[model samples]
Target: MSDTATRPEGRRVDRTSAPQQGSWTTARIVKLVAILAAVVVLLVLPLYVEEFWLRTGFAVFAAIIGALGLNLLVGTTGQLSLAHAFFLAVGAVTYTYVSGTSGGTANAYGGLEWPPLVGMVLGVLVSGLAGIIFSPIAARLRGIYLGIASLGLVFIGQHVLNTWTSVTGGFNGRLVPAFSLFGFSFGGTDSPELVIAGVPFGQTERLWYLGLALCVVACWFANNLVRSRPGRALQTLRDSEVAASVMGVDVRSYKARAFLVSSMYAGMAGVLYALSIGSVAPDSFGLALSVQFLAMIVLGGLGSVTGAILGATFVSSAPLVLQQYAGSLPFIVDPGQPGIVASQAAAFLYGGAIVLVVMFEPGGLAGLARRLRPTTRAPGAAIAADGADSSQHSTPAPADPSTGGDNR
Candidate 1:
């Protein structure tokens, strides 16, 4: 039987919103298999990967979290912010003070020595509070103006971190207390001993898994948030604030919420960063860090969750990986050689990538992936996939011969 004949006359297919008739679509199966394969790979990676790679993976995970937060604010909400590093410093400093121990010859420093988990929670909360406090000013500015205003925050934060000797440990910075939960430490041998098929799990292996779990949770939450109602509202605001307000979206309120959520994510990232570096320094969170984050989202593609992850991996891992192989790579020079170092090399590479992506592929890696995916629609299917109403649609008339194929 013909499919068209089975349908009533004048009935539109509504292909954009209709459910798939097939039980096992090729796209669905591919997606399922890909996810399963990725999960399997992540599960066993710690067993085979070396410590250097494992540590690099942790750094990449931290960058992923930070990039995701920045993407939400800059890409999703259309806010150009350079103050992300300030919030990260806030979270890192808070975690250090809350979980650290008193030190120095004169006992000038102070710390509560609270549980690491409590410190992590407080880090997120304090970072969100900082965002909330800044939202009033953020709400008042837009575009380059807001970017300039946020730039000032980074300097102010740096000064505070440098001067706050008791809390921040002054310019030298403070050691980050090792994270532990329920008596199981993420560092040292206190982590439960385990032998899995002749492979002994150590601190590096344990931290790899920890980082994997957190990255998974961060990605999952970000994916869900971007597909929800609030995500749509933010996208609307990004495209046009006047239009969004006309559609009943509270512009200032939504902007504030976006900032709050983004900063909280940054807080989580900061905790991970502290753990990764084993210290929190005033110089660590600076304008350069903020620019690297911006580069991450830009390279990954704005408003694309997966692209952000890919970008973070590329940005975070490239320098460390390059430094590891600096002796072999032709153009890369060693740190003290005076030529372009691995970090600078990575910056140049991604900076060029940003320009190319902006010029040729604004969607970034995610857009490229979308273009590479196989099309699922059947041949001759007269259906739009963007939720357009077919009832009000019409086909264009045939071209006129006298107008030379142009519609006159």
Candidate 2:
């Protein structure tokens, strides 16, 4: 009797001594709460912030949307892309050409005047169509092959925009009228304009809201996608193409779908970019721009959408912010006419960041955030902490199966 009583007490005591496994971990409940909080903040943010910051925030959102799209197709689907920026150009040019056109021949990619809506639709559709056509090649290639193939599209896109002077206005690009919704131009100076205290929201702020709206839609869709049958099929290919094929997953079709989805998102993003600037220049969508997009996806992590957004935000903002600050720094080189510190330095830093993130963290900002999360006796923390411990005893992959599959 004494032994039985003592044993039971001891067991209870031991259980009490140990921490709850899920208690400190990040739960789906916590994530939902955090997301809700973020949304609330975003809504309230524009109300209090100035026009410039509003634009800045919106730019971040646009980049996030585009990067999130890339993460889905490339991160989960394991496709390499280098022509996303060109797709962006397509969107910008298409939107502008459409807005400024007289129902007759509006300028298009190669100077084929098209109707506005038609031009926008055609631009996006053409990009998607290109994805399908390029799929067979994407199917045959991996790594550098896909990259090289995509690079060719960059030059082709540049040539099309440059040579098709009638449509793209050759090297000059085109001016775009403000994007309107429901008869209200986003930032128009007219009565329906977005104004607060006599300061109307500029093109950037208006475009930002447009971008945010699109981002919400994109994220919602992507969230559903990675959880659905199609998303599962994508992961099946990423992990083991042979296994996926053996399972009757049409790998070629999946890869093509990834490209198509990514391009579509890029196309939409281009619209916002053009609207924000109120103009489009061929130089804005150059080969270097494509490389930057690649760097964004890579640094953000291949398959994580949140990571993609974070990466895009940083990539897009870092340079401009740095250049502004660099000007105040003493002994900085005048990169401008007698200018010392130039935007070029920002690009160099961005490149260096890419290398460091790739070689060292691989998971980028998302990974860093995960690492910094306290593992204080929580549920998900157990796995994270377990893996952290296991990392010392065994070599582990940079991403977990769960996170690696998250498209957004």
At residue 112, candidate 1 shows an lDDT of: 94
lDDT of 1 by residue, 1-408 (tens): 333322333454533444556557667798889978997998998888889999999889989999999999999999999998998898888998998887663224868999989999999999999999999999999999999999999999999988988888888888888788878888864577878979988777777888888889999999899999999999999999999999999999999999998999899889989889988888899999999999899888899998899889998898999999999998899989978899999888889999998999899888888888877784224354332455357565568789999985
Best by TM-score: 1
Candidate 1 residue spans exceeding 4 A from truth: 1-25, 104-108, 189-192, 378-408
- Residue 161, candidate 1: how far off, in angstroms? 0.7
Cα lDDT of model 2 by residue, 1-408, tens digit: 222222311221223433564554346578889988988887666667776677667667767767876787678988777877878887776666655653322334333434445656665776677677778898999877788898888788899888877667778777665556656556556626557766556665566666777788888888888888999999998888999999999988889898888887888777766666666778888887777777788877777777787788878877656655675765456555565464676677778988998889888878877888864565444655664565576533344468875534
- Give the Cα error of residue 160 in candidate 2, in Å: 0.4
Clashing residue pairs, candidate 1? none
Model 1 worst lDDT window (10 residues): 1-10
